[model samples]
Target chain A: MLSKKQARAFFLGGTVVTFLIFIGLTIFSLSKGQDQTNHEGITEQVVRGKVLWEENNCMGCHTILGEGAYYAPELTKVLDRRGEGYVKAVLMSPVPWNPNGRQMVAYGFTKEEADDLIAFFDWIGGIDLNGFDTVVSPLAKDKIERQTKN
Target chain B: MKYKSQKVAYWFFAFSMLLLVLQITYGFIMGFARIGFDGLHEFIPFNTARAVHTNLLVVWLLSGFMGAAYYIIPEEAQRELVSVKWAYVQLISLAVVGVAAVIGYHFNWWEGRKFLEIPRQLDYLVVVNVLLFLGLILATLFKGKRKTTTALVLTMGLLFAALLYLPGMLPFDSQVTDSFFRWWVVHLWVEGVWELIMGGILSFLLIKLTGVDREVIEKWLYVIVGLTFLSGILGTGHHYYYIGVNNIWLIVGGIFSALEPLAFLAMALFAVNMYRKGEKKHPNKIALFWTLGSAIVSFVGAGLLGFAHTLPQTNLYTHGTLVTAMHGHLAFWGAYAMIVLAIISYALPNMTGRKLYDSSVGRAAFWMANVGMIGMTVAFGVAGVAQVYLERKFKMDFMEVQAEISIHFVVLILCATLFTVGIIMYIMDFIKHGKPTDEELDLESDL
Candidate 1:
């Protein structure tokens, strides 16, 4: 039963509200510091694992350093969170516990390959972006670098 | 031999229903996998099943729509289809190509894009769509009747759909450019062109069912089509925001995509208003269910949920998450699936001269489907929000977060199970109990 003017007014009001929400979120995101890491050089095993990662197209599901599909979790920080041993263990666990009793068939990796993957993950965990936000559009690469220097 | 148009429509409608059953089964299995990951590798892995579920949905809905267009276009033009044989050819080719594509997907041969994963073997599917589009255009033109606004809008929508792949086919070296064009296919098809098509078809069905003045329905159709293209084309900008695009895309995409919902809301209002004005007393309650249900659900699913994450700020958290899946499941169902169902309901009795076997049973199935869809949407939507919090805001250990949200997975499984049951009931009722009476056959002559 709204008149044309009333509908227009209602739409304008809604737009303003959405705009404000967007601005608030943008500001909040800018405030959060970028995550960084500090670690040592990669080994031969780690290098081999990196190649496997590409060949298998793991990035199709799992993101690393916020640069892949969101279907799976980020693996860049995996080593820091779970340590090398736990990483290998989870990789080798053919039947990980499913709380809802629905079966997830495990892709069982070889023991040596699992260790190499852990090493590669550990290498990725050590990259230091110096707390400049990395989740924004890749076009903001320069701005991120500037922020890091400041 | 007689009523060839109706016969073709019903046959394809039946095919669509069969595909719907398979898609729902896959949907349930995928839902269960979300809850428990123990038996994913059996025959249909999660990714494989998900691809099949989504692709089959697209195929079945499009087939039904093709059938509906063939049947309704001629009737609205007050002439027989210009070439019924051509229509049959189009259907046969589309079905053959569609089935081949689906089989390829089941065997894990895909193009790797989520919804665009039809294998190279079915690359000719687009050619088939183009042929059908041309057939429809020719039929409307040769009828010698002036094109109604509804027919014009539907034709334009089909034209856009045929041309949608242009950007995707551009020889772009950069992945980002390719991705941007991909959204042109995805976003424009669903948001822009599909909305117009749905508007046109909805108006046609409402007019036929309610015996309303064609002018009134056509006017509503015009407004909806205008809003659809105006809001939809620009709204593709929203998806461009995250994919290595400039910041201006954020503003353009966010603003326009946010406005896209208003057009859908307006369409819903128009339909309700028409129903109120019409003289027919619940002529076909099943058609009304689909018509009204589609309008309402599309507004909420495609429009609201689309706006929820249209902003670049929100997109950062919700992109590629289950939130996106929730939007997709409901939007496709509301916008495409329900419209096709409406067409089926409207045409079935006409084609068969059968009174719906049991009106109450059909109505009951409608409620069950609606309720089940709402339940699924709510469950998945909340789960998506929880996922955003766990992954983006809190940045918790990923596996721990997954373990905590296993309950949401269980809820999703339950909702999907309920939806599957409703689908089964509807299909059973349609097949076993749907027979028309002699009086209904006599009513067609009144047209």
Candidate 2:
């Protein structure tokens, strides 16, 4: 037996509160996340490589920061796993590495371009991402203990 | 068509149908490509096809929403539309912009953003076109005799949706920053404001088709709106969990998003209860079916299926998998797409002065589309679970995992065929309704 006036008031109040929560969480997350993603800071090469990555639509296949197609392997941690030289060789010739038809197109990058990409991968590799999956998240107990000590 | 200007909705609907055909064509191309049939790989690659398919689906839905607003506002406001000519102009501009963006995608002339791929330059055109649309609707509503809650909610949704698009357009050098604001548009629109639009349309159809008192239905509308905000606003956190965001979002997103289903569940119950309480005097059986179907199915698709992976635990392995595609197809179909079809089904006969309601084709369209979509959801769910296990859990190669799940896409294509057939029949019936007439303007309310 909800009356129209009651319904209106209820909706208006609930909406304002919900909006506040969303905004609060977004600001909090953005402050923490942006700091973490750029912790290593961007170099000229990293910036140029990011542009090249976008221009060639590298994200069309590989995910950087876990936000692209699932067709290919992740590139965010490539520098850690494959090293700079390995990344350079793969970019120079992608078919030998991913030749199962779902392969990267031949980008024909110059040496400087490959070096820039390597720098970009190196930058992202340092980002914690706080472990995008929950599997590697710092335990709640550890966080609580640290906060209490602080 | 209580107002002569309401005839403009016809063209918007016709345009939406045209885009729908193109959307399905792209869907078929991608579906075939999933199974090693890479005939169009050289020119229309999977990424390009995927972008075109998703973008067309979005535009068509927006066009449908705009049409619904044009048709509903004049009638609810009890006035002629402020400007019918401008509405036609808006439609043509929308089509031109859509075609330009689609063409640009082929030659790599667009932004690489997944859904927001219409290059920043064209985003300005979209903003201008939507402004014209909002101006007309707002002007007509203000000039009309009565301003109902139904009308206001729909208008608010459209206004907020337009405002939210600005955040996505802002330049950001950080990928995380770009994605953060992208969700402001994507997550907020679908989960937040769009629900308001759906509620308004559902309320209108329930009023007309169920013969319910307006007071009763609008009361439920308030509740649905309340619940939508209460849950859906925070529910955006579900996406924030694994996108290089704060770890706190994992807990917040899990709890709030899990509650998001309650809103859809409430809508389902509200529509069903209203139908039970009211006398069915309007006699548009097909429209009623779609109205009730959208309500119930949205709960299953957007609510139940969404909850399946909303928890951080499940989403850890399932994020961006076909599980998302599963929830996406169903939620869009059940919530937005079905509501558009319902409103069109309800409005067509009224506008054209026809009563072709209980035809075999219309009923078949309702059942086949629903069944086909449910089948597709099941297929995606199966494939998604398998992908999560094989790739995420076992560390298998991405290509090998995709190959193992290729068989499920076979099921997806078969069901998509049936869904396509149902849509074709719906278009046939739309054509059969012909065009709105001035003669029908003076007709009595069915209620």
Candidate 3:
């Protein structure tokens, strides 16, 4: 077996390397990336849709931005995958669409409300989360407020 | 019972058991809700129930740790605790804060983060509560006759765990940034420093129960500490993989987290080896069983199962699915939960001068809980694999996929019921032990 000093040196070296990597990578996550781009172009309707999404706890069933429940499909890319018209139709009467499916608890949105959710989905889909660490910009400080107020 | 003040730990543990009951009750509430019971939907929605259940788990575990520290430190350091009055006050404050947060969750006054949903206003109180606990533990350890390695490692684990909570509290406007720091508290605590605490407690228990040499056990404690930090600190990257962090985590996390099992493997090996080497046997069979069980099962649950999803390739499909839930149920139960129960089982009879270790219910409690949790882990595993394939691989509709797996929740409830019964029997045994008495103080001493 190795001496005590060798064991200590090995342990110390490993701890330092691992800890530094963690600190360095955390900095990389916050500071870098195309995700730091502004949330500038989100329209009033889209923002209203964001508020609607939160108030309804769409996350209770569906994952938005990859952080919500896994019960339903991830809505982050739903607009692209399902298309706006189909998303609207599903949101319009979610229960009948999937009669024997997992419960979405029919919120019974009107066509306009469905359109708002689609717009919100469109806004989320445009962002480049690149299949993981879905970074939302801190620069979009007043974005939620602007939507709710509108 | 070596120290008069150590009796306060009994109250802390009793409080912890109360919270566990509430926690399981809420788990049932949600389990029923999952199967379309939904009677409590208006009052306690699934999300609210979820937050309460998880928060209670964290609180009770913290309480258990505090109780363990109180019981272990005084004996290890060869001194009575510095203050008994302040310790009781701290326990009450912890209970009050824990209860208030649970109530706050039902009213939707929470931050809506997964585990950090303690409503920031109350987080300040938790900080205060933890500081008071550290103050007492550190004072006792430093002021005592001998500062043992076991005591110091346990203290360090508790201290660092408190410090990690600050990152989660920082005002991060970005969700990605918020999640990055959140893992510091979650991953770092469970996979990182908490292993140190576990090692320290295991060392103490092995020394007492196995009749092993103190020097031999403490030496293993050092190796465990080294392995935990070597892998776990960087293993935080594992959670960072798909969470919108930098892509380097994919490699860094995959490599480092895969090595985390080594620390746990060492723990299992250490315990078994210590038992084999010890020629003299300790009479506390239940405590020894729990001690050895914690070491072995933690390897299987936290070590092997954790490794199962640690690699990027597997985690990509299993990230937030039932696979994560499966691992969570087992690792938490196997590692932290079992160790806490081991200490309590060891300490309760010694504390209250009641020797009930030979009872039938005690044996039943241990076996049923372990068996039920293992069954629950398997059910979650099957459901997780099914969900991953149907939704992720086959491109099936998400709702249709969930309906397909609703059957597993049925099995989950059945096993959870058994697990609950085991816990109840354990609590009843605790009650039977009565309160600590001065007559019992002569039963044991470390130095």
Candidate 4:
């Protein structure tokens, strides 16, 4: 029979060992050499656009990088799927953009803000999402591939 | 109740219940919105509703955990809490922070991060409030006559939970990095330390209700929590698989995530075996139901359903779809929510000196809530599977897929209504117990 002391040791030892490994893995993955996150692409416009995204809580509705409320479309590949012009138009629209009857809160953003958001989308669209982009947004993938072929 | 200070737990439980009701209301709003009843869209948009719903779940569960600590720590330590006055202050501040966060969500004053959207300002207040809470709990435990394993584990869990919250507060310019650390708080708390808390509470409850030997229960408690951290710590990789992280997570997460169910399975088996071995069955049938239900349901909900989509291959499709929600709702309900409710059910009678332990109302509440929740899970699973097929596999338009699957939301709403009725009855039972009376202090031994 396992004693209480041994059980406690098992708990403590498992916790410490696994925690160290988790930390090591985190460091390894985030290191610059292993960087798939495209951290350098985050320009001033992209930062401001991210600020806008956060301020409006756009993630409440839309998912980016496959994380969100699942209420709205995933915006990770929005620039590829909709093109910059349509995205810009939607952002700058004075009224709620209800293209499919699901109303998006109308911010009526200035063109500069819209441009910044577009830049953010462009940056996000460029990241290597380990095939998630190709899987989730096949249409956008097709569009990008077609454009490259052109 | 063992001590006058334990009476303070009643107020915390009351506040937790209040927040739970509000959380369910926000849930209904989102559910209704899903099925095209977006009348509240102008006021409470889907995003706002979602933030409120998730944040409120976190708050209510935290409040309940605090209440459980307040109730259990004093008893396990065989002493009154260190400072009842400070405990109340902590409770009030927690409620204040919770209310402020919910109200802020409505006004769009949030950090826009899912689950961690309480804004940086309120996050500071939360830290202060939690620190005060830990100080009181730790002081009581250390100053007591004897230190029990249950008390230490519970305190450790609380302490670690507070420490984990700091990672979520760290700023990161890269969204991927931000998300990676966000799981450090959310995933670690739920899958790791929170299980310790759950184990502590379960050990306490089993000792009291099952008349089981404390040594036996505490031994298994250690084993259960050991299994939790062993698998759960590296299981954090499951979230990193496609989130712009290294492929290392795919292998690490897949193996660890598969092993994750073993913890819940151990938990369930431990609880059932303890019950069968128990010679003295305490009269608190409702609490027993919840305790046992929490173990079994969590195994099925958190363990099995989670495994259904945890693999990187499957998660590639179901990553952000309704499948995650399907697992999330049941997992939180079975694991955290039910445990909190079980402790409350067990403590209320002792605190208020009203032994409404085996009431029909309580029994009804138990069955209705469980059945309703299972129904809701099924609805979500069907919707999510259909979504994975039409949207991901078949490459249908997102909106088109939503329209096709909106019927599941209708089913979800119906099941949720039943679940709400169960909660309302439980509240009614709670009200019947009235307020905790200091006169009942140390009158009847907890066992």
Candidate 5:
């Protein structure tokens, strides 16, 4: 039988402990990695891609920058995982996948739009701050112009 | 047995049970979709099933609680229900509107969020809730008793619930305002108004079941209600943190929501203390199970996990993740569902002239439900962490992210299955083995 004063003390003590833990964890996370920048003016493309993603409700299935629907893959580091050409090819192939039995239908895009999408992916795939491997695929400098220009 | 108030209560319980069955079945289908999307996509898409599951859960819990209030208030006030016929009218109207809204949702008519998607199918659901609110107000007013603090808090809760719904229907230009108003309805109702209702009901149960002085229980009720408004209203800030809102919401939401659990923890302590100090041996030990279970689970579910994500920093990671779902499932069930069960256990015997149910089976069911809920919460927490790691940390392929975290998903499915089994067993125990005796009937009038 804890008295009222004791109960109050217990709650206050527990809250302080919890608060400290949250702060400590956050600081720990922040201190873990160094920042890296591969693209200078790619913010616009990433922003455009984000708008397009929401318009199409892509986040309803896919996640990007750690947000959105969980049904699809994370797109933040896709550029690191798949190069610019593969990204463009996947976007423009009109046949997303041809697995053993299941097939992913293509949302057909023009060549220019596909390249822009790849540029957007490339932008996201380049964020590597905090030692977190947010990069999805590594981008080659030659392909960067082609992807961005498209 | 012959009392009209008791009959009305039973009918309300029955209706609530109907909705509960539908909600759980939808939940199962939603789980199956997660596991085998290709197999079940056409029959019941994930979005549709999720909408139905969450909506039905809210409706059923509210219905059961409304029914419990009708039964508890009349007895506490020591008067016949002011308008028995009006009560029946309110019940039937709310039930009809709720069912119509749910049916509308099934047919692809929804506003698109989980608990807020009551569709234009029967916009009258809002009207019905207001009517129910009026019914409660009128009943309390005409009963010729001073408004107890508990009743006052409950009435305030209902009023807020009704008022909150209006903004949801407003035409807003900015999605931010829309989202804010939506949380005002959804988050405030559950974490704020609903807590008030729980405090009132739990106090009422404590007085009746423990033979504790109303003064003691009512004092506890006042404290709980105070914490509720103080912490809960401001606690809405937690939801605002990530939704493109101003940064000030970060501090306000984090601090207040963090403190919100204190009220729940206090309520748990109150219950335990009352049970310790209780002089009379409660006739139905199972009633105590419902009572204690409601307190402990609500504290753990709503208070603890709620604190975890209340901070802006944590919310950034946990928002929209499985962690949110885990918090919701346990908190809502603990606050509303278990409270309703507690009230039902206390009143059902009196209403039906039944003796107490088999205590052992009731106790077993309680443990089963509690264990399964804890399991589900753990599974979802683990899954949520994995999700953040894959999406935020590793930036893994989307499908591969899900596949990697499939183990947590499987654990959650099993936990839900276990929870459903426990609920079914409890329901069966109520119907088949509940106590039926005149002595139990006299116990209510003795108070």
Candidate 6:
């Protein structure tokens, strides 16, 4: 029979050990040497784009990096899927962009704002997603084929 | 009620009920929107609805947990709350912050980080509100004659929950780093500290209802929470995998997440065994139903269903689809939501001096809610598995796949209506009990 004191010790000791290891793993993953996050690739335009993405709450409808409301399309590889021109038109359009009858809120963003978002998408599209990129956006497969042919 | 200050918990429970109704309303909006009846699109867009639904859940559950602490602490500690006035202040401030954030979400005044959407400015106020809450709780616990394990664990859970919120607020330019830390708050709270809160409350309820020995119940409480952190801390890696982090998370998250169900299994077994061992049957049958149901349902919902999609291989296909939604709905319902309702069911009769235990309406509420939620889960599960096949595996267009599965939302809406009826009845029973009375204090000994 395990005593109360032992149970308490097990709780405290296990919490401390696992939490310490979690911290170590976080540091190891985020360190520049092992970094796969493309931290240095974040330019001023990309930063502005990220800001616009959050400001508009694009994630409310659209998923980027496979995290969001699942209400709209996943935009992790939006640049590769939809060309910059189509994306910009939708962003700058004065009316709600309803594709296949599902409506998107109309922001009527300026050209600069649209460009910044596109830049953000471009940056997001460039990251290595450990094969998730291949699965999520079929157009990524197309883009790879195009690159190989060229 | 042992202490007069325990009467304060009724008001919090009342507040929780109010928020819960509002939360369900927004949930219906999203469900309708899914099936193409999005008439509120211009006013309450899908994203706005999503933010409100999730944030309200966090708020209502927090309110319930705070109410549970307020009610349980005084009894377990053998003293009244340190300051009832300050506790009311905390409650009012929480409502203010919660209301302000929900309204802000409507006006595009949010940070837009999924669950942590409250703007940076409001985050500071939340910190203040929680700090005030913890101050009262901790003061009461320490000032009392006794500091039982149940009180300490619950307080510890609340304290760690507040600390974890800080990580989500930290600024990060990299989306990867930002999301990585976001899980520190979100994942850790649900899987780690919140389980501590749940265990504490479970032990308290079992002690009272089961007539089991306090030492035995509290000792099992320690083992369950110990199991919770043991698997849950490393289990944060499950979120880390495929979020642009290292591959180590794939292995770490997979193994730990598989072990996660063991904790819930322990909880279910403990609760059932305690019931079997109990010689005394306190007459609060509704509370017992919810308590035992919470344990069993959580094992199936949070534990097994979560295991259904948490593997790296399966998650790769079901990552952002309706599959996650399927698991999340039941997990929150079974684990957090039912426990909150259990405490409310148990405390209400005692607080108001209205022993309306074993009402037909109460029993109906229990069955309707559970059956309705199970129906909703099945609807979501079918929609999710279909989504994984058509969209992820077959590479169908997203909108095309949605059109194929919109029928599930119709089923979801029907089941949700049934669930709502159950909740309405529960609230009706709550109202019939009326307010907590000072006269009830010291009326009877502990059950």
lDDT string for model 6 (B1-447, tens) is 889999889989999999999999999999999999899999999999999999999999999999999999999889889999999999999999999999999999999897999999999999999999999999999999999999999999999999999999988888888889999999999989999999888889999999999999999999999999999999998898777888899998999999899999999999999999999999999999999999989999999999998899988888888888888999999999999999999999989999989999999999999989988999999998998899877878889989999999999999999999999999999999988998887736885
Q: Show model 5 residue runs off by greater than 4 Å.
A: A1-150, B1-3, B433-444
Error of 3 at B52 (Å): 1.1
Clashes of 5: 23
Candidate 2 vs. true structure, TM-score: 0.93
What TM-score, over all chains together, does every model reach? 0.78, 0.93, 0.88, 0.99, 0.77, 0.99
| Model 3: residues with Cα > 4 Å off, grouped in runs | A1-13, A33-65, A81-124, A127-150, B443-447
Q: What is the C-alpha lDDT profile of model 5 across B70-108, one tens digit per residue?
A: 776665555567777777788888887787766765555
Residue-level lDDT for B361 in candidate 6: 95
The residue-level lDDT of candidate 3 at A78 comes to 68
Clash number by candidate, in order: 11, 0, 5, 0, 23, 0
Using Cα atoms, each model's DockQ against the true complex is 0.09, 0.31, 0.21, 0.84, 0.07, 0.80
State each model's CA lDDT, in order: 0.66, 0.83, 0.79, 0.92, 0.66, 0.92
Better of 1 and 2 by lDDT: 2
Q: Write the per-residue lDDT of candidate 1 for residues B194-218, one digit (tens) a residue.
A: 7877987898877876778887677
* Candidate rank order under lDDT: 4, 6, 2, 3, 1, 5
lDDT of 3 by residue, B231-322 (tens): 89988878877765567788888898999999999999999999999876876788888999999999999999999998987887777677
Candidate 6 CAPRI classification by DockQ = medium
The local distance difference test score of model 2 is 0.83
With a 3 Å backbone cut-off (N, CA, C), the pairs that clash in candidate 2 are: none
